[model samples]
Target: MHDFVRTPAAVVAALVLAVAAAATPAGAAPATPRWDHFGYDAENSSFNPHETVITPATVGRLKKKWSVELRSDQSCSSYGDPIVADGRVFISDYLGISAYATGNGAKLWSHDWVGSSNSPPSMAVADGVLVAGYTDCESMSDPNSGLIGLDVRTGKELWSGATAPLIIEIVIDKGVVVTAGSDIYNDTATVAVRVSDGKEAWRKEGRRIDVTSANGTVTGRDVNGTGTVAFDVTTGATRWTVTRNLSTGTASPAGDVFYGSSGDGDDLEAVSVRDGRVLWTAPDNDGVVAVDGTRVYCSDDNGIVALDSRTGKQLWRSDLPDHGALAATVAGGVVYTAGIALDATTGRVITGTPRLSFRSIVTGGVLYDSDNGTLTAYTVNG
Candidate 1:
């Protein structure tokens, strides 16, 4: 947070950098190749072309171009940032997903997927087509939810189908749409769907699919059952499949191919990208929480903790808050975890305090939660 009274100039400079950084990348494939997923690339790094860490000195300087009220809907919880491609912003109003005029925020078209969402669905655009994922009310525990494709220019629904029984998330790798889901009723099967038409191109025979892909290779495993499988994205050929008894944690980092799993107790092991090898393991991580490239932040009996991405060693741990869910990201040169501030290098809680959500895309940063009723726009000071 910034003191509204002092160093207004410093605040302004920070805002400038932030505005300069908010620019998202798009490409010619969908006329919006720039946007890939959550972190704006398979790596889930959340770093855009201009996303260098913005600091406290830089936070206050930003400005709000304009805020859209997004037709007041009691049902919508806008957790994901708006995606862009071509000349429009692709977003899901609490009502449904729509393509809005990038400059004026005018509604061009929309496609609604009736799913119970905690966060907005992510988008993948390729070949002038748009693809997205949603938690299906239709398929609760199963990811056999739904995948919808829209003609980027017109709001016309090109294709919509059940790619997976429960599609927890979707990824666009090398122009193909890779989704995760496991149908419990039909046995256990994970599948990869083509983004252009909601078709199941390749699916795990009878195994549950919990894989994450980058460029094209699949990296992940089935949780609550078999570990997961590492596969070549191009041929669906298995690189490695694990039967190790463990809880499937966060899908491996898409690009680095780094995968992780939670053991019988509170333990986490980081797997290798070159080969399906256990690189390192951290002690007793009860809840293997958020996973990113630089670090893997988890919840444990010790409270929120941080581990080195490559070594799986505990870099920092702080008993900021125990038992509460933790959210984290590697930004501002620190592992910003919920309840505690794990020093980026040391993982010690130099700063430990409570915060609301969305404050900085970290756990405590939630400026206004869904319960807050109709948040028009969020205003923050560095």
Candidate 2:
């Protein structure tokens, strides 16, 4: 509509611009594989399907790619779980929130919440937005707690909302951000917030609240003997409620199923995500549960057991060297626990690397040992 330059120089510039645009594909600039939430996704699967490079044949040769100390002075400790997304790794610790380059562990950016309550922040990332729970340490008896959302690339604050007293865990799923915290009354509560904007969706009161989700539904167990409840992830409507003696306060979700332990802390049970119906039960289980889409892994004081996710049938059980001291992460056909990597199907220790630190996470063929602050990448050696 306006007057345009039609000279020879303008024509050459137009040709150069067109060539440059053709060189790059749409959304190709920053597209990368991301481990966006706790347990890799809303299901807390702890399983990575995109990780084809690290397999049973190659896990032994995994070498340390790089490591970054979140607390260089050892003044604070890293808490909660980290998330890998947008070509970066984000972590929240006692010191503050920080991000690193996923490939090399180079420090990208960091933010210090000056009044931190000496607790670690649990974080989740979605669509370049990082959400984390933190507490203000103005006093030991009464500290302010809240959740903050930041721009994943720049570490800029997007929005924040104050709630509860101690925000411990966070999960982002189905466009809903849920956070659990212990209120001032010593009871735990789960607060659901909309992801598009920092707004409260619903709040429920309980104790030892452990939250998990799958298929647009979220579940939690109020370890105060109130049992478990499932709710619609988007609307926060109660879908089902099951009253059982759930003392462990932990549950793992896989699709429409979840596994939990009883108040006696010995019997492990699986329940339906739809109507809270008990599907199957395995006795003498300690209820430390994790699902890898195909199998349900549970640990007790004596050992670890593998159950078929569909039928709750016992596949194999492995005795732990640490006597269940270390938690388990099931992925890539390997059950990593207590510094031992076991074949998931056979329950045989594949490698006693001893370097498999407690509370480590595997994503995109890399094992991140948060216990010692190290990141190791794996490859299949020919």
Candidate 3:
């Protein structure tokens, strides 16, 4: 019998280790910070797919983790939603901008703007900079509004520019910052500025803009009744204009779908993101719509309706008592609206559902709720 040369145990072990190391993925490159925009993402999906810890089965045992009170006033509503990114929660109210640690709710830093006039500054973050629109409600005139860029880490003001008047709804994409004016007389005037140094890049009149899933494209609803128009984000040039119907509210863009109102005042319409083709319509008057790419959640008069994102088919519906849902957002396979939690697939309220605040969002496996003047975080359990 020929004697076989046996491999050394140490050598075999080393070979196995190398093969296992190669098979294992490099500790999945740290996930990117989420909740960067008011609608949760640039496409305004308001969906957090990475939130695996807080599931429908586990949300019933959610416990309050921490809470922090934000500054606000009676005159100005703190309607600007807080954004979470880079392990920090950034919120804006009349008192100014503040940052808190996502894990401990510890105050990181705060910055106040001079002559901000007690208005909720539209806040967003891009390229490591927190961009917000400061409105001088006391003046309400030219130069009364400006865009400010701040260092996200230290809450330091990096740049500011008086680009427009009464800036509202600050949306950032790429390097361009779009600021919609709250001018009662001119809802159509929109401006874009460079986020790096707060420089005006372009401007357009008579166009209220909405973001889309595509980059460099924004939907502009004509205030003069010309219809819903699409414009270039960089040059303010009109790409296409559909004059058949009046568009209303903030457009919810997901993939190729743009969901908004049709000015008929009773229904929400889904249009093509490419050419504004009517895809579907549903009954809705003042309900806020949030999409998760797979499903759309809306607070309608009938209650919370979950529709298939691709076909707009009603998947399920749940009725809430108050119907005063502040914001409807989806994450962790659950739908949260007006302090209630519902299963995304079945639309049934989960048991032991914690009464959240009027507005809340699930991020990093924690639910953050803004109630009265305090922001509270909750730990969910199954």
Over 360-380, each residue of candidate 3 has an lDDT whose tens digit, in order, gives: 777777888777678888896
- lDDT string, candidate 2, 248-359, tens digits: 2233433676666765666777777677777887888765446654567777676878777767788878888747724566555666777777766677777624376655
Q: Give all candidates' CA lDDT scores.
A: 0.49, 0.62, 0.65
Sort order, TM-score high to low: 3, 2, 1
Estimate candidate 3's RMSD in Å: 12.2
Distance from true location, Cα of 138 in model 1, Å: 6.4
Q: Sorted by lDDT, highest first, which candidate order results? A: 3, 2, 1
In terms of lDDT, the poorest run of 10 residues in model 3 is 1-10
- Tens digit of per-residue lDDT, candidate 1, span 263-331: 465567765555656777777666555555455667666476666676877766667554533444443
* TM-scores of all candidate predictions against the true structure: 0.67, 0.81, 0.84
Which candidate, 1 or 3, has the higher TM-score?
A: 3
Q: In terms of lDDT, which candidate is strongest?
A: 3
State model 1's lDDT. 0.49
Query: Whole-model lDDT, candidate 3?
Result: 0.65
Model 2 residue 177 distance off true place after TM-score fit, in angstroms = 1.6
Q: Give Cα distance to truth, residue 381, candidate 1, Å.
A: 7.8
Clashes of each: 38, 0, 2
